[model samples]
Target chain A: MSIIIDEKTKLAVSGLTGREGSFHGLRNKAYGTDLVAGVTPGKGGQDVEGTPVFDTIKEAVDEAGANTSMIFVPARFAAPAINEAIDSGVETVIAITEGIPVLDMLATYWKAKEAGVRLIGPNCPGVLSPGKANVGIIPDSFFDPGPIGVVSKSGTLTYQIGNELKQAGTGNSSIVGIGGDPIVGSDFIDILKLYEADPDTELIVMVGEIGGDAEERAAEFIAAEITKPVVAYIAGFTAPPGKQMGHAGAIISGSSGTAQAKKDALEAKGVRVGESPTETAAIAVETLRG
Target chain B: MDLLEYQGKQLFAKHGIAVPSGEVADNVDDAIAAAERIGYPCAIKAQVLIGGRGKAGGVKIAKDVDEARQYASDIIGMDITGPHGEGPFRVDSVWIEGGSDIAEEYYASIILDRGEKKLLAMVSAQGGMDIEAVASANPADLTKVHIDPTKPFDAAAARSIVESAGLAEDALDEAADVLAKLAEVAREEDATLIEVNPLIVTADRNVVALDAKVTIDGNSLFRHEDLAEIADTVDDPQEQMAKEKGLTYVKLDGNVGILANGAGLCMSTLDVVAQAGGAPANFLDAGGGSKAEAIVNALEVIKSDSKVTAILFNIFGGITRCDEIAKGIVTASGQIDLDLPLVVRLDGTNFEEGLAILAEANLPNLHQEKTMLDAARRVVELAGGAS
Candidate 1:
C-alpha cells in the first residue's frame, strides 16, 4: 500500500513525444506501471514504449482511462498542460518540468485546485509508490516496499534519504517529491496529510529546504494535528541571506525559511530532527522502532 | 537582477510610461550637458542599485547647472557603505530629471503571490516612505487588486483600489488608469516584479510614474529581445565563471564549498554541512548527466574561491550516473591543486563503481563517506566546527 500511487493507478505522460517523457515512459512501463496512454499535441495516433498517444489529455483519459498524469512539457507549455490534465479529471498530476514562470504557475495552481485535482509538482521528481508503480524520475532499483513514508521538497534529496532508508533496512509506503519551485503545486502539509492517512505508513521523513513559509506552515500543521511520528531535516543551513541558492524557492529571506527556525518549529512539535538526509532515515527508523 | 534608478527610468520610457524628462550621465562633463539639456531645477539621483538614495545624500535637487555638476562630482566615484561591505561605488550614472512639485507620493507593485494564484497589484497612498515601514505600520494603507488572467483588468476593481488608496476625486481616475496600465505592462513584459516606488500626483493635477523598477522572469527571456539585451552579467565571479562553463552555480559567502549533482541532494549537502556547524560557500549543481568536464568546471569554480576551507561532494546518481560524477571528481582532483579537504558522499547507480574510481585515485585530503551523515560530519570536522 503506497501513499499516492499503486499498481492499479492509470497513468499518462503529458509530453509523451518529448525526450524526458519518452525516457520515463519506457522506464515506467518496464517497471510495470499502468502507462495506458500519453498526450502530445499533434502527435496523436503514435505510441511510445507501447503506450498509446493522444493529442490532448481529454482524449487520452477518455480512451485509456488514465487517472494520473506525469507532465514533461517545457516551461512555457507547463501551465496549459497541467490545466489540460486537471480539466481531463486526472486525480493526480506530477509535473516534472522545471522553470515554469511563477505567474503562470499561480494561475495554473488555482485552476487545478478549483478542478479538485491534486498536483505533486510542476518542477518535481514525481512520486513513487515503491516496488509497485513509480511515476517520477527516481531510480526504482533503490526503493523497497515497506512502512516508512518520505516527503521532500527536493527530488535528489528524496533519493538520498530513500537510499539511506533502504540501507537501514527500512522501506517506504511512498515517497513524494513536492518540488523546489517557489510556487509548487503541492506542499509539505498536503503530502503529510496523505502520509498520515496511509495505514502502511508508520514513520515519515520530511526533507525541506529554505525559502517561503511552507516549512513553517507545515510545522504548524504537524504540531497541531498530525499524530504520526515524523523525523525531519531542514536543508540549507549554510545558505546565505539575500542570495537565492539555485532552487527557485531556497532563500533565507527572513526568519520563516531559515534552517534553525524550521528545526526549532519542528522540534517544538516533538518531531526528531536529523542532521542530514542519511541521519533523517536513521532517526525515522529509531522513532518507528521506539 | 536589480536595476539602478537610471536603468529603471530608461525601461519606463521604453514602455511608453509617462516619466519626467531625464538624462543619465556618468561624469561631470556629461552631467553638465545633461543638466543643460533638461534645463535648470533638476533632480540628480545616484545610480547605485541599493535603495534609500535620497536619505543617503545619493539624491539631491540641483537649482542650476553648477549645482548639478557639484552633485554629480560628489556622487561619481564616491563610495557609500552598504549593510554589507563597501566597494568602489561608481556613480555609474546620474539621472537628471526635470523637477516637479509632488502633491502626494504613492506606491504600487505588480507581483506574483505564489501562495495565492493571482497577479497581485498593490497600491498605497504612502509611497516615498520605505515599503517595509508602510507594511509594518500602516498595513491598511496598502490596497491590493488581484487580477485574474482569465478575466480582463476590471476598471471598477481598479477604481475601488484607487479609492482604498485614499486618493481624491481629481486624482482617483488618473491613478486608476495608471494602475491598469502598469498591470498591462507587467503582464506584457513577463515581469516577475514591477515596482513604482513613488507614483506621484503632481501639483498640476496629473498622475505620473516617478520611478520604475522591474524584474523579468529569466525563464521567459527567450521571448523578450530587449530584456535579454539588458541582462546584468555582473554577478558573483564564481557564478559568472560557472555560467561560462554551462553549469548552474550560486555563490554564497561561506567556507565550505558544495559540489553536487541534482538540486535535491545539493540542498541536502548544504543542510548537513550547516547542521554540522559549517557554512557552504556556494551552491554548484551540476545537473544530472553532467560529464567529467562539467564536473571539473564546477569544482574549479569552488576551488578558486579563497574562502573555501573544505569541499563536500554529495551525489545521488540516477540519470546523472555516479560513475560519471566519480570520473569527474577524479579529473578535478588531478587538474586543480586544492589546498582544502575534500569529502565525498556518493550513492545510487554504479555506486560501487564510482567509489572504486575515487579509492583508486586516492587524492590527498580526499575522504569518502559511506553515507551522507559520515560525509557531512567529516566535512564539518574538517571545516573546524567545534561540535
Candidate 2:
C-alpha cells in the first residue's frame, strides 16, 4: 500500500559485488526485504549475503522475479547501470550513487520517463516502506507503519523528521527521499500523486529545502488536487541567499527557492508550515490525530 | 565553482568565440609586458572569484604601459571587499586585456537554472551593472530561452530570442550567432555556467565578448581535461583536504563545525545551529553511507579548520549506520587529540549502539542529546552561543 516500495515488492541490488552494494544488500536481508538477487557484470556467479549474483539485470530479474532494483554503482557507472535496470524492465529503480554528472542523469531521466519506469534518485537516500523494506540510506529505527506519508528532498532530514514524528507518536505510512539534486529522477509531485492515491497514507509530511521551484510547483499541485492534510517543513531558512548550504543542487538562487517563499506558498495552499523539524512532526501528529 | 575572469576567457577561447587578447599576470612586470604586447589602452582586471570587482577598484582602464603597470601593481595581490564585505577577497592575479570602447553593452550567459530543467541562455541589451539593476528593478528586460538537450541549439530559436530581446538588426544576427556558439561550448565543456558579463558592441558595431566566466560541473570534468586543469589552488586548506578524501565539504565563516550524515540534515543542522545563536563554520555531509575511515577523515578535516571552535555530530542512522558513525567518531576522538567541544546527536537504526560507542569513549566535553534542539543548544552554549 506504500508509494514506491512495499511489502510485496521484490528487489535486487545492482553492483552487489561492490562494497556499498553488498553492505546494503545484507542489511536489506536483515530487515527481511525480498532481496531476490544481485547483479555484478564480471562476478555473476558470486553471492553477496546469500543473494545470487547475475551478470545482467535481465538475467537477475528473470531468475529471481525481481521487479525493482537498488543501484549502488559508482557515479561514473551509475547512469549505465540504471539504464540497464530500466531497459531490462525493472518497474522501479533507486539510484543511491552520489556525485553523478548532471548530463548523465538528464539522459537517464529522459530515458526512464520514456520507458515508463519509476526512477527515484541519483544522489539520494532512496525510499523506505518502514518495517517492511528500506531501499536507500534512511535510518530504519526512526520509522513505524503509521498513517502519515513522509517525503523529503534530503535523505537525512527525512530520518530527523521521522524521529521527531515517532517521538510525537505519529507513525509513518511511507517515507520517500526524492533527493536534493536539481534534476532528480522523481519530483515532489510524482510522490505526492502516489501518496494522495494510497489508502494507507492518511496525512502527509513533506520536507523541502531552499532550492529549485520544486516547492512552488508542489504548492500549486497541493492547492489544486491534494485532499490529504499536508504538513511541510522547509529547511535552510537562516541560510544566505544565492549560496548552496550543502547539497549540490540545494542553492537558493532567487525569490522562488528561498525557504520563506516556499513556506508562504505552501501556507497559501492550506498546508501547515512547520518552521523546524520538531514543529513539523508536532503539526503532522495533530493533523493526523484530527 | 565560480571562475575568475582569466579562466572564463580561457573557456571562451576554447569555444572559438572572439574575446579580447589578454593574459593573466601575477605581477606588475608580467602585466606591463602583456599590456605592451597587446598595445596600450588595456584593461587591468583583478582576478578574484567574486563580482563587483570593477566598483571595488579591482578593475581599471590603463591608457598607457605605465598605467597598466601601475594598475597591475596595485590591483594584483590587492584585497577586494566584496558586496556586504563578507570576504572571499584575495587577489592573486590580474588580467590585462586590450580594451574596447563600447557603443553599447549587452549581457549573456548559459546557466543550468533549477527553475527549468534544461540549460537556460539569458540575454539582456543593457549591461555593465545596468543589467543587474535591470534584473532587480525590471526583470522583464531579461529575455531567457531554455535550451532543449533533445535538439541542437536552434539558430532560428536564437534569432527569435534576439528579436524578442529587442536587439538591432546587425546586433541581432551577431548576438544570435554568439548565443549558438556559447551553447555549443557549454555542451562540449559540460559547464554549469558560462557568463559573459559585458557583451560589448564597439563603436564600429562589432559584437565582442568583453569578458568570459565559465563554471564547469566538477563531476563532469572527466570529459574536459583543459577545464579540469584549472583546479582552484586558493581554495580553503580544509576544503582542499576534504575534497581529496572524496567527501563534500564547504567552508563557512561560522565557528561551529557541523558534521552530518545527509545533505538535508546537514543543511538543517546549519539552520538549527544558527537558530541556537551559533554560526556554523562549515557545511559537511559525509554522504549517507560513510564508513569509519570516511567519518574519521571528515572529523580530521573539521579539526584542521582553525575557525571551528566546536563540533556538532548530527547523525540520522538508517543507511548511514549510527553504530558505524559512532565507531568512527570514537576513533576520531582518540586519533586526533581534539581541543574543542563536541556534541553528538544520533537517531534512527542502530543509534543505541552508536550511543554506546560514544559513551564508552567518554572524551572530555563530549555529550549526547535526545533532541536536535537540545543538542544544538548544548554545543552553541559550549561554543559561546546564547542560551
Candidate 3:
C-alpha cells in the first residue's frame, strides 16, 4: 500500500483565511485532494473556496470528519498550530511554514513524539501521493504516481529530482519534503522506515544536504533495517565549514556533517551514493532494473 | 549567530550570573576611561567573535591608564587569527573589565545536542584550554549532563555537575547557581549554545564568568526581539544585497558566480563548478518561490562582485517557474551592464517557455546546457578561456 498521504485521507487546512492557506488550499483542491475543511482563529463561519472554515482544529474535525491537518500558519504561530493539530487527535499533520525558530520546532517536535502523531514538516513543501492527493505544495504535474518513493530536505531540489526521474520514465508512489530546518518534524530515517514498510514503493530515493547527522543516522537504519533498494544523493560537497547556506540546517560544522562523511557512511553500508541528482536518478533506475 | 565575549557577558549578567564589572568600548580613549572606572589592574580583551584572541595577543592586562591606552590601541586594530583556521578578525572594539587575582578556571556550557534530541550541559575544570582538547586528553575532567526539553536544568543538577568536575567545596554552591542561571538564560533567550569558558573562581571565593559565548537559535529569532540587538547583518555588499532581498547568499573567493533556486541545488552547482576546474565567486540561492524580482536582485548581487568573470544560472523549477526566472534574468541584464560570459540551465516546469524567453534576448555571451554537468563545464571553460 502507499505510505503516509494517499487516497482515503481527509484533509483539513489550517490558517485557511490567510493568504498562503487560501492559495495552497485551492491548489490542493484543484489537484483532487479530499478538501474537507479549513481552520481560522475567528472566521469559523467563513469558507475559503467552498472549504468550510472553523475556529479550531477540533471543531473542523468534529464537523468535517478530517483526520489530517495541513498547517499553513505563519512562522511565529507554527509551533502552537502543530500542538493544536496534534492535541486534536489527527493521524498526520503537515506544516508548510518556513522561518520557524529551531527551539520552537524542538519543543513542538517533542510534543509530537509524545503524542505519537506522525508529522511531516514545519519548513517544507509538504507531501504528495501523485494523483491520489497532494498535501503540500509539490506540483502534481511533475508526478504520475508510480513505484519510486522520493524524500528530500529541499523543496526545489525534490522537484529537480522528480523532473529527472520523470524524464527517465520513472514515477513516484509518494514524494515527501521533510523540511530544511535545523530541527524538523521528521528525518530521513523516518521516511526510510515508512518506505521500507510500504509494499508499493519499490525503490527509495533520498535527497539530503549537508547539515546534521540525520543522513548518517539514516544510513545506519538502512543498513540495519531497510531492505528496499536505496539511492542517496547529498549536496554541499564543496561548502565551506560554517557557511550558512539557503536552508537553515544546511551548513557544515567543523569536521562533522560533511557531504563526504555522509557519502562514506551510506556507501559503507552498501548503499549507492550519487555525485549529482542526475547520476542519482540513473542509480535508482539501475537498481530497480536489477 | 555567535555573540562576542562582551555581549555574552552582558546577557549572562542580565540573568544574574555574576560577571566581572565590564564595559565594551570602540575607541582607546573610551577603553582607558572604562579601565580607570573599573579601577587599576584590569583586563583589556579584544572584542572579536573568533576564538584564539588570547593566543594572537588580542588579550592583555593593564595596571595603569597608560598601559590600558597602549593595550587597547594595540588590540583593537590588530587582527585575531583563530585556532580553527576560521578567521583573522580585524578587531573593531575592546572589552575592559576588572582583572581577577590569583584564581582557578573552569568551563561550563549548555548546548542543544541534535543527535540525542536533548540539551547537553557540559562542564570542565580544565577551562583555559579548548574544550575539544580537554575532551580528547582527559575526558573525565569534563562532566556532561543531558537535560530534557520538558525539564529545567536546576541548581541541584548543576551542583552535581560542578562537584563531579572536582570544583572546590567552598566555591561549589555559587558555581552551581551560576550554572543554573546560564541554563535559564540559554532557555529564556532561545539560545542554541550558551558557553562560559574559564568560569573563574576568584581569590575572594566568588564564582565569576570570565568570558562568555552564546549562539542564539537563528530560527527562533523572530520571537526574541531582544536578541536581534546582537544579530549583525551581512557587512559584505553582495551578501547584504541578498539579505535585503530575502535570498540566502554567501560570498566566496573565486571567479565564477553561481546561482540556483534551492540550497541543495545551489550547493550542488557550487560543487559541480569547482569539479569542472573553476572556482565559484559566491553561493546564491534564489529560494523556491522566488519570482522575477528576486532573480533581478540575485543577478545584481552577483554582478556587483567584480571578481566574477562568468555567471551560471541553474534553475530547477518546481515551485519556481523557469519561465519566470528567465524573465528575471533577461530583465536584470537590461538593468545592469552584466558584461560577463554566462550559461543558463533550465529543467522541470516551463523549461521550453523559459528557453523561449531567453532565446528572445540573443545575448552573445550566453550559452545553454540541458544537463547540470555540461552546464558546469561550459561555464568553467568560458570563464577560464576568458581569463
lDDT of 2 by residue, B292-356 (tens): 99888998999887877888988877667789998987788778887888898888778888888
Every model: Cα RMSD to truth: 3.1, 2.7, 1.9
Each candidate: chain B TM-score: 0.88, 0.92, 0.95
Ranking by TM-score: 3, 2, 1
Candidate of highest TM-score: 3
Query: Proportion of native contacts in model 2?
Result: 0.64
**TM-score per candidate, in order?**
0.91, 0.92, 0.96
Candidate number that wins on TM-score, 2 or 3:
3
DockQ for candidate 2: 0.57
**TM of chain B vs. native, candidate 3:** 0.95
In candidate 1 the C-alpha lDDT for residue B357 amounts to 91
Error of 3 at B78 (Å): 3.2
State each candidate's chain A TM-score.
Answer: 0.97, 0.97, 0.98
Q: What lDDT tens digits, residue by residue, belong to model 2 across residues A22-78?
A: 877777767778889899888888887678999999998888999999999988888
Off by over 4 Å in 3: B64-70, B385-387
- Alpha-carbon lDDT of model 1: 0.80
Backbone clash total, candidate 2: 3
The C-alpha stretches of model 1 lying farther than 4 A from their native spots are A252-256, A264-272, B14-16, B26-29, B65-67, B77-93, B148-150, B275-279, B333-341, B377-387
Q: Candidate 2 DockQ category?
A: medium
At residue B128, candidate 3 shows an lDDT of 80
Query: Interface-residue RMSD per candidate?
Result: 2.5, 2.4, 1.3
